[model samples]
Target: MGQVHVVGPNRALLISGSGASGKQPRVIVGGRAFVPWIFQRADFLSLELRTIIIESKKSATAYGVMVSVTGVCQVKISGFRESNSGSGSPKLEKDVHAILLAGQHFIGAKKEEIEHSVASTMEGHQRSILGTLTVEELYKDRSAFSARVRELANEDLRLMGMELVSYTIATISDEEGYLDALGISQTESVKKVAQIGESVNRNEGRQRNAEEELKAQLKINEAKKKIEQSNRDVEVMQAKLKEEVNVANARADAAKLFEEAKLKQSIVEEETKQDVVRATVQVDVESEKVRRRRMELDASVRAQAEAELFKKLKEAEGIREFASAEAHRIKLIGEAEAEALRKKELVEVDMLRLKADAYKEYGQAALATRMIETMPEVARAIAAPLAKTEKIVFLGASGGSSSGPSALLSEVTKGAHIVNEGLQAITGVSLGEILKGDSSLNGLERLAMPIALNAVVANQGH
Candidate 1:
């Protein structure tokens, strides 16, 4: 019976002696494998990660400046193994070789031994990298320096059946104070730049504030100017409106006055028409009265003449009868008296006929002539009141003592003129033309004169 060797996840199992395959050992990772106790021996190589701290003191850089460096490296063994038939890809083949090497060298080795071997190799590579870089390069770009070290040590470690998982420079320092002096210089330069930038920013802020203020002030001034112009426009508009209102009022007043004047003129014209109508009516009434009076006079005259004629004829007949009984001389005397009476009767009848004819031909003109003849008496009657006054007191402005009488005479004359105009309007005759003997008289006045004289004579005889 063979013993079962159980392999852990982090370990590889190695079998040596007679049970191993050919010249190489049999490697197993994980699971169980059988080994004869007498002929074969099994060993485990840990596949867990290992950490190494490498330190170098007083290493000279490319500039001959001595520096000290402390670094950390992590390593692990590859778990790849070769198959039994040895048929695989080149990359797999390489990995198998690396795994076999790791098993050969580290099999049954202690953890400290593995760590020492790896640490020694990593330390040597770190020192070599340090010699090529300046102290500033090592400090400023530690990751780049670490990566260079890892790259350089990977091949060597793999050949030893180990792989470098990571490498980093933990600390780097120089024996001299050059790095300290450089830090001080850089800090001063940064402070100076910050102060200059702060001053420039503050100046720019002040300049922008001034420009904005100027723009705001200009806009305010423009607005104020516009406001003033608007106010002036309002004032001008108000003045124009006031003027228009005044013009309208004036026109209305003028129209009112014109309408009033037209109304007054129309009233006067109506009054004049009324007066003319009244005058015409009065003239007709007077003419009718005159005609009736003339007729009555004619009738009275005719009655008286007929009565006298009858009386005379009877007297003549009696005288003839008495004379026939007496002498012939007495009959001759009676005939003479009777003949004289008849001649007188004939003359009166002829006169009456002539008077009637005159009245008919010049009725209106005769009336006018009669009125004119009585005008002086009418004037005397009108002035009769003034003559009765014992004391004459003139009121108002007068030129002299004569002014009163003259003014009275002027008024009387104006009244006479008005009456004459009335007569002309009513009777179709102008008394003024008759008195002045103007040729404008229509020949009625000339005919009326003889009739007027005969009327006077006939009246006296009666």
Candidate 2:
């Protein structure tokens, strides 16, 4: 018997040397295959995923910023098996070819050696990708960077009969604190944005609150206005009701007054009818009485008129006789009185003629005599107002020449001088000239004496 070999789900069996499908190797997966003891040899390849740690140091980025990178990668040999459908399709052929290549490259290799080789290849590709990208791209989006790195290394890995299952960046770092500064910048930016968002939200909240308050106030004002309007409507309704009540009352009163007036007019009409009947009867009775009284009055008036006519005729006769006698007596008295009056008039004419002749002959003496006769009366008349004065007041200085009786005498003298001036103005002759008996006193002096004397007598009488 030959040695028996078993293949697991995660492993592939490779048979090489003579009797192994010519120069090409036979691959077995998920089953056992027999190998002749002397002519053929068998090897196993791990088909399971292998973890590769890739670390790149001092790798330069596109911007010349040096960075360090650490990553993990899952890799495996390409697996294949005979198709159950027994079809040689292009995709199936391609899978078979890949498995053949994987067996040739990794057959009999240790897990460590495979990992090391894959890590070296991944690291080189990581560095190349790093060179093409910015440090921010490498740090911020490691997945995309890792994907790019895996895509670049996968081509080479496929040539080596391997496939990259997955690539992940475990850590990204820098020697110059570039990543730390980047993290800090991002953290601060996030904090600033958060603060700004909070402030905006707070302001919006306040604005909404203010709007709500304003709306509430507007509602309250509208409500109050409505209430006031309602009150006004109520007041108007009440006033209208009161006016209607007053109007109704006034109409009722007018109706009552109208009825009362109608009743009173009926009563007055009935009373007037009764009064007319009574007045008609009384007028007939009074007419009959008046006719009788008129007949009696006519007879009595005729008798009285006859008596009065006879008495008047008698008195007329007596009056005629007395009048004749009285006329004769009056004639005798008139003749005698006429004779006495004619004689008296003749005597008076003769006396007036003689008096006029005497006055013409002695005009100066007559004027002088008149003045002498009227001077005392004039003096007394001039002093009459002073006699009636209850008391005399002297306002002048006591010891002066104008004080006492001297002032009184001076006032009297001034009054006399005023009188003399008046006389001169009236008669064109001064009192002094008249008293000196100046020969210039013509007929004017005679006229002046009488007027002066009459004025003085009138004053004395007052």
Candidate 3:
């Protein structure tokens, strides 16, 4: 390994050695390399190079004013040259100093030495171009000034195997302040124009605003006048409506009163008719009551007369029955009297016969038996008053004392007195006298007694 010379990708190799190349415009080499000789090793090199080109304070005159110009240039290798004989000087084509070895032939050179030569050459051209141009032309037309400088520098840069990529005038200054004075004059002129325009706009705006305010005021007055007229019209309409409503209300009230009066009159007439009808009905009711009472009285009188007739008929019926009964009783009494008289005659005949027969047979006993046969009739006559007696009271003792009267015995005595009273009434004979006088009677008197008894009974019968 003799000086390996491994070239980078951005570099080219200038192989000037005894192995394969002499000075054939720097045999461009990149990537890996091989060489058989050590003392003839080739140097590695780049294909492109960039360098800054700047110039300081170069003086130029314009309109008798002294101005200083400062400028910058960007430079790079653009081409290459090959000195095949490996003789003469290094001639530049694309000014690729990285491989060409600037200012020298058949020898290696540094990139800084080639770049310094480029800068010096560009500065000399820039200063020569500015010396003929004025400051006004350079400031106002920098593009034209820069073009002229590039045109002048391009030939020398090409000869050096370099090209100016870009150039700019960074600043231009003058000790007299010429640009500042020109800027001040132009800026004041623009300011005066803006001030004049602003003043005109202000006046126009004020005039338009005043016209708008006057037009608005006129519309306000017109609207106010119309509103006042409308209010007056509304007041007139309201007054008319109020008058109509009052008249209608008054007429309605009068009509209501008239209807009320008619209703009252109708009600009064109806009440009067009802009162008269009530009085008539009352009188009819009273008359109907009187008629009913009269009918009741006549019915009561007829019932009383009919009752009297029936009563009289019943009394007359009873009297007729009593009269018939009395007549029958009288007829029976006359027949019984006749029958008793006949029987008395028959008894007298029989007594005569019996007397004759008794003198021949029974003697006085037959006379006694004949007298006992009349004793029942005699007792019936005596007890006739007792048939009317409802109750009998014995006022005396149940039994009398031995020497005084006996109630039982008194009853027999009363029967005897009663029998004697009947015999005196019937035969005109006091049987008590016959019993009290105990004188014995001769046959003639005794016979006369029966005849006298018969005659008295018959005469009483008549």
Candidate 4:
């Protein structure tokens, strides 16, 4: 289908072509001819050589037979040639008859001449004439030998089939002095046309059968493709399902972990609550101990207060008793002092009587001097019983007892004395004054009588 340019005529027969290639070549060499162009390919040799050239009967009748009278034959065929058309082609059958009819005479020709003559002659395949030959004759006669070679070449052409074996000459020889050559064209060759038509019918029938087989194969392939696609879809769906299942499992695991964490948290909270309760209980115990201790301390304080009150009461009672005893002692001392005064008053009354009597007697000249002196001391004693009175006595001589022995009485009561010292200091003055008042000079009223008593008491004081 890809065209190429031809160079010249007859160039393919020149045997100078290069090797096959993908591009079609038009061969030319030595200024001779052009060869056919064909696209070169690796499988080009496998393409059917279907174009077989079969010449018409007109060409055979116009050319003449391919043999002579001595049984010589020639067959002419072209192995390869140029693709181009030309004029004035060679006359083939007349040339082979001329040489073979002079057969024994031609044997004397040189081997090179003989070989050249055979090479130059023609196509080599025939059947009916060449099969009947002697080996010695075939060797000795160029015509017989050529005929035998044609017969063997016939078998080679027959095996390829009717299409490939395009031309045949059954008997071309110089024995008939002329040969019969017939050509049947594909158009007018009834026997050949019938065979070609029969072949076309058989091939068409085979083609129809092959087409049915191809359709069946196509349906099978399409079904297999559908089946493969379904399998792929199933695999994809299965993979997606597996992924979903795994995700669900992971979620379940997470939920379980969450539950476990919650459980642990609850346990911890419960433990903390228990610890708090225990601490509260301990605090309550301590509080109870403090309360009991405070109650005991209050009771002890009350007992101590009671003891101190009792001690103070006893001390107050003892002080009252001591004060009462002191008061009683003072009252007794006053009573005794009153009694001594009363007794002293009675003694003074008696001394005054005695003094009056002595004075009377002395007035009548019947008493001694010693009686007056003793009489004064007795009066002082009487005054001591009543110590509040300040007395100076001027008693007349008749104020004493009427009859008394005062002289003897002075000697007998010489031990009687006044207790007061202040009264003794006035005794001398009293005696002097008494003598002066009593001057009736019958008896000696001495002025110095207090002096004699002074001498005696003064000596006693020493």
Candidate 5:
């Protein structure tokens, strides 16, 4: 019959059914089941095996100190499948049979006997090994002790179909407080060494800081010297610049004198040429004078005609200028009248448009409310100038209708009324109509009062 079995990653399969050929099967399976028969973990497993050596029976070290040792070991079925030589075929001995199970499970009566036997065998060897070594040797070189135990126990474990993978000495302790006392002395020595090292490091750090400061001071001194050298260099450069400027100025003056002298020479040469030209024209001038006198008599008559004609031309020119000026003046007057009429029409059109817009936006009452809104600000503005009045003398307060700050208030009201009249004259907004709160603007002032009060408070906060 075909059977499937599951095996773990740490396990190997061994099957022995009817007509089995070998004692331990060569087949090993891992991962998923594939017609598996028997399986068990073949990899290493650890056992925490410890033993106590009584104080009277404690294993003595080389120095005569007795210590109890606790150890653990890792054991596994050996990788070597066969025990005999190549010529002989291997069979499962009684010990191997006791270690391995028929059903492939590791836990059974025979398995326990084999494990106990291996553990006791290891403990016996551990005690024998500790008896040869001291506590000092055990602590300093625990690997050698564990290695020796494993070496000795491996042979016995092999007979049981098991092998020692590793052995570890978990702890070692003495009956007396010898280890604690030894640790205290070593700790004191370490503390003294650490203190000495710390002191040496601190002194070195201070010396390094002093050296750094000295280096910084040297650099500062070098920088100061460089600054002084740069200043000296700058002074030399300035002196050189000044000398070069003086030389350039001298050359400029010399070039100017040379230019002036050359100009004077050229002027003298031009004057000489003019004198020669004048002499040449003098002879022709005498002849021209004689001929001109004879023609003068005829020219006098022509000149009289030309003067009369010129006077007539001048009279006609004056008349033409006067006529053109009158025409220009008339045209300017006509243009001025047209411009005035156009401006008047435009103003009426704008006023009508504004009124229509206002009615559309806020009903017919907006004009009155708009005027009323301006009155509060205008009143404030008129009172603004009075803010400069540190003192006011009320001459008629004793005999007049109002007195004290109330009289001052009355004066302010009069100022506001006067300003309102001026605004009415300029912008044609009637303060009287605004104050009457006519039309839909009747309760607007009450609503605006809170807005104005909030504004004043916010400004004051700022």
Candidate 6:
């Protein structure tokens, strides 16, 4: 069904669908909607077209509505050419290439549109989408051009409403070396260029290797020198460090010793202080004892001195009294002796007068004497003498005395002086001259003999 060409505003695309897209809408091409006459020429359209059919739609949900849809159909020109004859030129091939390329792009776009419509309707939201073509034939070989293919896939994936979340160029090996080597084939153009570059780079690499060898040798020499210098420096530094270590060790030892010595010194000082304290305590105790003892001794000495002083004072007083008594007795004796001498001389006059009288009587009466007249006046006078008694006196006053001459004469008669005096008279001797006796005698003794002799003679004569 060939249609006549006409200039018109109602331009259209009369493209027929493939697979499940048989009912798909015809989109405008170059802003025209052209009616397709494929139904009248169904045999011609079916003969010339490659077709794929997908029967099932995807599952979708919207606002609690679950809509199950079918998958889209895909179409491509697996083979198309206006000329494959040797005489055919490149123009016809180019047109066929363009038509095939356009048809593939349309198939990819529609597939993505259907998938995005399902995704958007199911999600109940509008989202950015894209469509991309996935041509497995393009990935028949692995080469640097794969990078461009990956970029194209990623770019158009969103535009085509395709999700290229993950991408890998799984090379297909069904064509030539692609089939033999799993589609990892070398591109002929790239291989030829790489071979030429490899040859040219070989020469350049040789030149670079020569230069690098020279540089490496120089660096090796420099490294060797640096290593030798570093060894020398390490040796020097080691020697210096060894010296410092020795110094540090010596200093540490010295510090330790000094600290030890100081500790010992402190200990010694502490001990010395303890000893001093003990010594001081002992000295204080001993001093206290000595002081107490000395105090006791001093007290004792004082007591003894006081007692001796009292004793000596009493003895001195007694000696004084004894000496005074001796002096008084001596004075009394001297005074008595003096008084007796005076008394004896006075009494001796009486004795001589009486003796004179007796001698006169003896001498006269032996011849012729009157009896009455024989008593001489001298006897009478002598016998009557000493009628006043002898008295002891104290310092100008009369003191105590016993019986005077009469009692004294009685006492004298009991003494031996009478016989001695009589013997001295009869023997014609002085008594003092005869016996050399003390001439001092009691006055009573001296006077009594004469009167007794006179009385006795008178009795005999009668």
Candidate 4 residue runs with Cα over 4 Å from true position: 1-144, 147-215, 218-228, 231-239, 242-246, 249-253, 256-260, 263-462
lDDT of each: 0.66, 0.67, 0.55, 0.38, 0.54, 0.40
Ranking by lDDT: 2, 1, 3, 5, 6, 4
| TM-score versus the correct structure, for each prediction | 0.44, 0.48, 0.36, 0.22, 0.36, 0.20
Could you tell me the TM-score of candidate 4?
A: 0.22
Q: Which tens-of-lDDT digit does each residue in 1-462 have in candidate 6? A: 434333222222334544223554333323322333554211111112222222212212222222222222222222222556676663223222333334434443454554444333322211111111122323332333234433544434334323233222222222223223422344565677799899889978998999999899999999999999999999999999999999999999999998986776556545444543454355345434433433443344336653553443344344334434644654575475455436555433443454466556555321222211222232233333333324322232245533433243354354334544554466553332322222443323332333323322232234
Tens-digit lDDT string for candidate 4 (348-448): 34434444654565552222233332443453343233344344232334656422223212322332332222333653323333324334321112212
TM-score winner? 2
lDDT-best of 4 and 5 = 5
Show how many residue pairs clash in every candidate, following the order shown.
0, 0, 5, 17, 2, 23
Ranking by TM-score: 2, 1, 3, 5, 4, 6
Name the runs in model 3 displaced over 4 angstroms.
20-23, 36-41, 44-53, 62-64, 79-112, 189-462
Question: After TM-score superposition, what is the CA distance of residue 27 in candidate 1 from its true location, in Å?
Answer: 2.5
Evaluation by lDDT, superior candidate among 1 and 6:
1
Better of 1 and 4 by TM-score: 1
Per-residue accuracy of model 5 over 96-204 as CA lDDT, tens digit each: 3423532233333364654666567777888888878866567778899888887888777666656576778887777798877666876898899999989999999
* Candidate 1 local lDDT, 1-462, one digit each (tens): 679999976787878889588978787777789999889988888888888899898888879888888998888897753445545443332255666788878876789998999988998999899889987788778999998998899899989988888888887776687767767777787888888888888888888898889889989988998899999899999999999999999999999997886675455445444543454455455445433443443344336653553443344334323323432433454465345436555433444454466567778666764573454345445445555555654354555443432344345555566666776898787765654433443223322322222322222334
- Per-residue error for 53 in candidate 2, Å, reads 1.2
| Local lDDT at 308 for model 2 | 54
lDDT score at residue 359, model 1, on the 0-100 scale: 61
Using alpha carbons, what is the TM-score of model 5? 0.36
lDDT of 3: 0.55
